[model samples]
Target: MRRARTSFGALGAVTSVGVLIALIAACGDDRGGFIKNDRAFETQSEGGAPDAETCLLQCSLDGRSIIDSCTGGVVETCADDLACGAAKCQEPCAAAEADRSSNGCDFYFTQPLSAYPFASCFATFVVNASNKPATVSLELGGEELDVSGALFRAVPNSTDLELLEGPIPPGESAILFVADWDPTIPRSLGERLYHTSCPTAAKPAIQADGYFRSGIGDAFRLKSNVPIGLTWMYPYGGAGTHFPTATLVLPVSAWAKEHVVVNGWEANVGEPVTQIFAAEDDTEITIFGSKDVTNGVGFAGATAGMPAKIMLSKGQFVQIAQSQELTGSLVFSNKPTATVGGSECANLPSKAAACDTLAQQIPAFEQWGSEYVGIGYRPRTANTEEIVWYRMVGGRDGTELEYDPVKPAGAPTTLSAGELVLFRARSNDAFVVRARDAEHPFYLGMHMSGADGEESDSPSHGGMGDPEFVNVVPSGQYMSSYSFYADSSFSEHSLVIVRKKTHGAFKDVWLECAGNLPDWKPIDSAGQYEYRRVDLSRNFGPGDSFGEKRCTTGLQRMRSEGAFSATLWGWGKYASYAYPGGTAFRKLVEIPLSPVN
Candidate 1:
């Protein structure tokens, strides 16, 4: 019983004769007389004749009622006030014929900062969770792009505008290298090569991610099956320096015009940046800045507590960076848009020596959840405790939050709309958070501890881990199965899984690499939910300083009898990346935008 809300435009236009035949065939009654309901067909002509397309569109909008009538061998008359010639009457009549489930089919991608001097080898891992092999393609502004010979390669060079297609087997994944760089070449040399090979009227300065050409900033469309999941990552970065980050790519169906950025790290330690991408033309966006936004164009400089407006078309985007943290900033658009927030390189607690690049696609306020299970990364060493930081942002005014075991020190019990709070916890100290109800949902973020050598006197004691940010998927949005990728570039890869014990024991869960997740621990005394930390691969040590490993162990598939949530993360010497395994992208609320002053 899926409902189609948006206009199909010219795609829905059909010949009047064809529509008439469909209406006649669908409206026939056993008594040889037309079924008529005055309430449903009030908009019919004075002669009691229905408009072909309007009637079909109305029936589609009626959803379950029309289906029920048809199942009971009764055909209810369908009509709408919209004229058949009007654009509103032009709807996809086929929408009512079948249910179109969201397999994460259509989505857009954006690259965050990887820092200068670091090789920006951007790649997206598409996992086919369907039963049938799926074809994957990328497009920008209606033009297909080439990704031939780019599968699983760190650095790929492809010709422009060439349509390249690939298939991903069911329960397996394929890597698409959208942007790549030759690490042997220095940043300056790479920039020169890019400009010489693809010169254009506007030569924008080289980005922190080291992407100097066009199309990198443009939002590219990824088409695939509805059950697929995408994880975007920059596999390589400066050795023993700025680390890379990964984030789950939210599909276009999950996108919204309104979002709020949660503070992941201290702004003073490094530059905090935010980016917005438009999926449609003529999109007007307004940002209510929580901090001063610098290095942005097409809008006036935004000061803290001020508003900035910008316009974008399909595939177009704007990146905004600032010295101050942009947490709690409100982004509103006239059309649905995707927003990403993070830092170029930020130190946790603002005192850790090592900093890592952070990135997470901000979900719409409507998708915020009232319940979340907070789990940290695995311990850096066998003896050391796994310490992590958590940040929660409120999506509504007067949102009240409650913790299952006990609230950590300095955690807030209540928050105003767009307010943010931070707290610390240990890896094994798992807890559940619940708001007053679903109406007062909030966003939760997890941050890995920096490699500050606190565990031992040596500076490299905690060198394998660093500050990284990953959004905590809501418990309600957990899916039963997931196909995700773990970058082989990282020495250690693991998954944090949480499932309801009431539905079934954790033993019911199955992973392609590790069967039945042998390790399970309870979160609280209630015994309703249980969690486990499973290692996919661990080769971190002296020889593997750069976090490189065999590519065969990168893709992973997991399933459970009931809904469960999982987080994929890995770390090596001063490098780490984390993101959710997948999300259902269910709409939980409707958050209105604030009036622009």
Candidate 2:
């Protein structure tokens, strides 16, 4: 999805009210202006200036400006071919091609699907509120779904979805896949999708890994003119008729460089894996405690100390594998990088043949907060208790620990660099972890047991009882309001966890549940914020499509008093998964307790 700086909000809307803004693309309108398509829509930022944000400068062919893009900015009349953009001028493309210096309509870029984790994969989309054709990435490899395929809302939910190229839309939803590798288009982006963590002037290009790779798993670079939510899944390994494994891939704008990865696989007693993809090149990365740091105690995949230093070219990546629990392993980079970590296949201590998979793109260190209030994950089977674990990263020598609804934590007076303290809890345990001081700002994550009790026959086939990872983020980084995507078009099934930023931060936690997710309850309230749990089912999922409904499987907003964060959960066939529903804008700090905006 192409999200431009417009009136639209950061995340897509909870309600589908029309938000249209006809902005032209950079091309010939001959009036010396840009000629854009109807697909353009603008969004309004919540705390931004009353006016919509200005557009980035695109040059004019004749070195002229039909209109200035922003107030007081340069009129930019350069014929520089190196100029990445141009105005959507009044002239037509056919006529503009005559000018050698013009960079016409180059904004129309396509994303190609290359290799994949499964022979066949399915993609479900949540289109931008913009009612344009951008319901999904227009290109899948070289093949494009019929533009009309986006109209899933008008189509009855009773229709067999597998037969359709995509769900119908007015910015509703859609599905796509590459049955084989042949649909490859002109490589929209090179080997990697996003740029490396380094800048061009600083080092070489570092490309990212494939969107859907086998052991490496799936990921997406959500760089779009129109905003949309995407969750792709593997057809096998799941229990029900639907695909088993699925996760929401955060947009590139949400990616970060440093991550305190928790190896959920360790809890399953299985080997753990973590993958780092460069957002920039010559990206010098240091992997602490992976193989390099802990002798053989770390990952088997590490190359350098192999834990201490990892040098990745633009878009390059390395998957760190470790047989032991990566107790407090840390990954740091000279610059920003994108990291994904989890177990390839892990079974909770049960030893079930059904070792389901787990993974999440870890957010950058900036998203880490000094405080965290955690709610336990539901156990996979009734009578079977869910084992929950918490890992605290980035605490210091003087770092103190505080807890509520308390349990036994050996509060240590000090913690060394790259050292993390781990805590384990049973199902439904409500607890809080806050560094006594901000100087020890840290992060928290949770791991739930595999689906041992989740299904009856699930273990006989592909996988069973796999542990899953969930990110409990810093409320300070949460969205004041945001929406989530449905896990499946079939049986309704969804749950979301939300917590307001500060005490009495908002009058109410939910604006509305969109009717589908009709149940909610206050879980924990003693901490700085209260957490409300919400649920939605197939009746509330993508069925009988009027389009996305309330509780689009998420919490929409908190009264403006403050911000809130969310994590969404969904299950299919036999597997379970969850992802942070909000975006992150982390600010790297050189010092602990540094003032963060």
Candidate 3:
């Protein structure tokens, strides 16, 4: 089996279409029709036994004894003067020459060949003449590299598979064993084997250990093209069946499947084509179908107790026929609502109206894609009347606790403070968020200190006091935005967290006046005082040092209008960031949030 890209959309109960470019192999032009003769059985003598003289064939030109047969006590041999198999054996022959086909075709084998060295290389293949139904057994060793599926492409010119099955009349069935031992080589890529006895003319099936490696167990390796996200690992694990034109799954449960229409196109069952785009709470993926798909097909697989299997870690293996040409669409089962400002935040003026909360309506299958990271809007402070966008710079968990709250080396700064900066990065977690166009503005907010718990320090922020009014309270939830960026020097980085209000133990407070962001409407500008309870248990921080420490900002304004609308950016706990400049990026903060929500 081959490893492929992971899929994020509703893989089960879904039929995704794929397209592939054609591959051609070299041959003289005679693409078909080769025949086999009776010479294959000419060696047998009368009474179905070889005569003594007939059994003792000639040897090679050098006169060396060629092995004929080894009976109970006799070691029969051939003369060395004969050509081994390659030519008529008039005399004894030396070792047999490598096997070759009638049309000057040489035998070859294909299998993986390295130990995960991380490159594209060829696996070793060997050719031999063995006409038997072969059974291959694979065992895992050395770090256990994953295999997708194994297949054999038939040689273009040869008699029907019956020849490989030993003439197919009683004395038939000779199987050959081919071995592939490299971890870095790709076997099923583009090679074909020559055999006349292939059980059926159809393609062979591929198998993977996606579900139940042994008996029922719950451990599974994370699979995805996105940097960070986790799929539930039911004991059954993940798996998908293949079809000539599409990889379709009809979810057994009706609730998991969703239907929608976009741009006037409706999704109908069993259509030759279909397209779906990703939604905010769902992973950012597009699904296309080559044939009309229905829940009935997918439901059968799911009801059979199959794990919610999708494609592999990558979606490349899910091939679709090119003729179908599907246009897919994506819609959230639950839509996300944006929140605008009011008295909910202490730093804002009592009458200011510019904060927006872009909250998601968590769906049954909770998933989020962050096209941009650390993105959000916040006020200057509780005492000021202006709104600005504060972003996350460089941060770290240090795998321990430390104290200090200064800017880290290469940390980014706003060219103009309070000037809405459109920063981008993975969320504290690493979901992917995107914009329809670069010009469209995003929504924003900030955090502020509250009355009772506004004067203590936590270890997450370099042991320095947490952002004035925006301390991390044990049980409060805050909505924010994020952006990730790398500079030309390859040494600078940033992670910014902006919130509307803060209410836990912290060090200071600010008074900021605010207005709505420049070009967006609010879902509830008047009732903006709603409170949501949250537990950020997995986040890293309490340190105050900006360098090597988590960076944060409290409310910069109560309601300052801007040109962008607010949106939510979330990344699960384990996400990796890849800086554009070829430098490796790792998560410095966990965002301290619980998954219970």
Evaluated with TM-score, which candidate comes out highest? 1
- lDDT of candidate 2 over 30-98, digit per residue (tens): 112222311011111111112243354433322234334334245543332222122433232322222
RMSD of 2: 14.7
> Which digits, one per residue and each the tens of the lDDT, describe model 1 over residues 458-529?
233346778789888776565555666665556776678887542223437776655566557878555556
Sort the candidates on lDDT, descending order: 1, 2, 3
TM-score of each: 0.72, 0.59, 0.19
lDDT of 3: 0.17
Query: By the lDDT metric, which is better: model 1 or model 2?
Result: 1
Name the regions of candidate 1 deviating beyond 4 angstroms. Answer: 1-103, 117-119, 140-142, 153-166, 182-217, 225-227, 236-242, 453-460, 501-507, 540-552, 591-597
Worst 10 residues of 3 by lDDT: 237-246
| Cα deviation of 402, candidate 2, in Å | 0.9
Tens-place lDDT digits, model 3, residues 424-472: 2211211112222211212122222111122222011111111111111
The order of the candidates by TM-score, greatest first, is 1, 2, 3
Residue 391's lDDT in candidate 2: 57
lDDT by candidate, in order shown:
0.55, 0.39, 0.17
